[model samples]
Target: MDLHEVCDLIVDCEHKTAPTQAEGYPSIRTPNIGRGYFLLDGVNRVSEETYRSWTRRAEPKPGDLIMAREAPVGNVAMVPAGLRPCLGQRTLLIRPMRSKVFPRYLAYLLIGDQIQNIIHAMTNGVTVPHLNMKDVRSLPLPPLPPLPTQRKIAAILSAYDDLIENNLRRIKILEEMAQNLYREWFVKFRFPGWEKARFVDSPLGKIPEEWEVTTINKVTSYINRGVTPKYDASASSLVVNQKCIRDRKLNLSLARQHKSRVMDDKYVVFGDILINSTGVGTLGRVAQVYEDLNDVTVDTHVSIVRPSNGDGIDFLGLALIDLEPHFESLGAGATGQTELRRDRIGETEIVLPPVKMRKQFSEKVTSLRKLVLNLAARNETLRRTRDLLLPKLISGEVDVSELDIAIPEEAA
Candidate 1:
């Protein structure tokens, strides 16, 4: 545990490359919901030309640890496959001084919440924070024992990360299925019926005789835009920022709840869909507030929609997600960060089947949504458990001598 005597491995994480797409440059973005090692913050994918543009881009080797160091700080991910090629912005890449330790072990050290406090100390500027090579060199790290011990800890944590990634992968598949269904049945006008399907006029523009166009307001009477504080309460409300909508799930883990104004049950309720009205490339992303959330409220940047007594609330969530193509087309305007006309939320035009069919769709989607949520929740829990286990095992705090995790061949 005496880390002071050990020489710390250090490298300046690269500034992210330009946003423009180039033939050689493919981008790497933080995975959704901080679910996998691939995620640190919002997703980023850069073209090869742009990846080369960063003055300090560091090519991580396999087993190297990558940490997001600025703007949004302390998100950590590992380079499992070894560094083939990756470019990052405001991140630190630590190449393990293998003579003394395993790179994976060092990665676990950087991720521990306790060590992050140490990492934060090295950033020079508070407003626009950054860490140079010198700063990274000075980063305090605990001296870990041997590779086997380090492997033990890394294994414990990696278990969670691995499971979380699995869940994310599953969700992606399911959501893709849902989206494809939407496109086929709704967009492409493909249905079980036939080639002779008839069209009819309805409230929501022209639609199939069996379909009806409707406004969301008719779906929910209690819906309205979210509340913003007259007085800022950094302590109280983490207004459901657009970032909260990810992985086709709403993550309020980052939402800060502060006290400013009164919040009623009406302001937020379970199954209530919070629509992101603003954010770069996130305009109109809908988050379904599933069970397990406390009394959380969103901000003006998002609009809250509640289903009517007869409407299938969960169905609405699916419908919105399925209609993402439509929402993207409508477009939002923002000078800097993207902002959309949220007031038109209830007014969004949607085509649906007859009342009975709509109800059936709602029920099926609700059931499927619950299954996805449960699986996702389980995945998150597993990943969290593993994340908690990593540092202790890696740091030699919680012993894991009995856990039989094979060391990578190169690591050995």
Candidate 2:
């Protein structure tokens, strides 16, 4: 069946960018549209007036799906019950016809391998892959099961999504706690025993008595990016690129296999901090390697920063993360493309707290960071399991009809 046949209404977004504010209704841009779910972290906000103006065609409701039509081209995410969001540029709001097809089921179907492949095929021969209104309406869907079966399949998948969402929330909270502590102690100069600590003037600013304002080069064992990889389909080693580092976390699944030889220092270690060293928007983003990554090397676009000593690796990692904005500003080049030079990063100023004080901070934040990493690993596992079931359930190859499942009220 055609997508238009299943959807009651498919509204295109306001062509112009909506004016954003500090806080208001979230504007669901293409970047926020993750597969089968929304990624709302750092989403743009618009005033109530702009939200009304932008959503004049049809306001996105709880069950509607927001799909990207360009840049990425076909990723889709369903709007949850609580979020009141307006469409952003190059996006579409799809409202499924409840009588014809279940909303969540259709969302799952759209992100499924078959539908995604079909969507990609339509974008072929285009300068920038995008869907015109006609093509979007004409996009085909695989044969759907009966409404009851559809609900059951959606419920089965929703269970996994529910778990993943829960973990994601927990991860967010854990990360905030970790970063907050770092800010309080280091940034605000409120670390324990601050009252008795004598103040001193430094190049960066005022600091505790014995603290040193140092450069990244002075304290790191190694500071350089990996060599460009010779990509081969059957390669065993993985290459971590800018895409692999996001939201201050390292996602190994995004890493691609590389056939190139990796030097000893080029390979990322457990405590190494990876920074996106090139490109306008991506440069200066940082993520710490949590687990042991075997035979994994980063690309030229990513620089590896390994600490000189074990005592302050945790402190150094969090400190570097806090300097992301500073690093971003330091990028040199034209507006479109910017590069964070190795020397610039090395010469970047960092305030080093006393050794004992840093060790104490590290002990506290390390526990929180570990919790965050554990939850992230759990989410990865859940995602893999859910992906394995998606195709089978959507295709009706694995019969879910006989298996009793409770359909959520939202889907009903």
Candidate 2 total steric clashes: 0
Off by over 4 Å in 2: 125-127
Q: Could you give the C-alpha RMSD of every candidate to the true structure, in order shown?
A: 4.1, 1.7
Candidate number with greatest TM-score: 2
Q: Across residues 100-176, which tens digit of lDDT does each residue of candidate 1 receive?
A: 77665665676676676666765545776654555556566665677677666656566666677788777777766
- Model 2, 184-292: lDDT tens digits are 9998888887788888899988888798999999989889988898988798989999999888888888899889988899989989999998998789899998778
lDDT of 1 at 251: 79
Q: Where is the poorest 10-residue window by lDDT in model 1? A: 26-35
Model 2 superposed RMSD (Cα): 1.7
TM-scores for candidates 1 onward, in order: 0.82, 0.95
Output the lDDT of residue 352, model 1: 65
Clashes of each: 23, 0
Model 2: which ten-residue window has the lowest total lDDT? 403-412
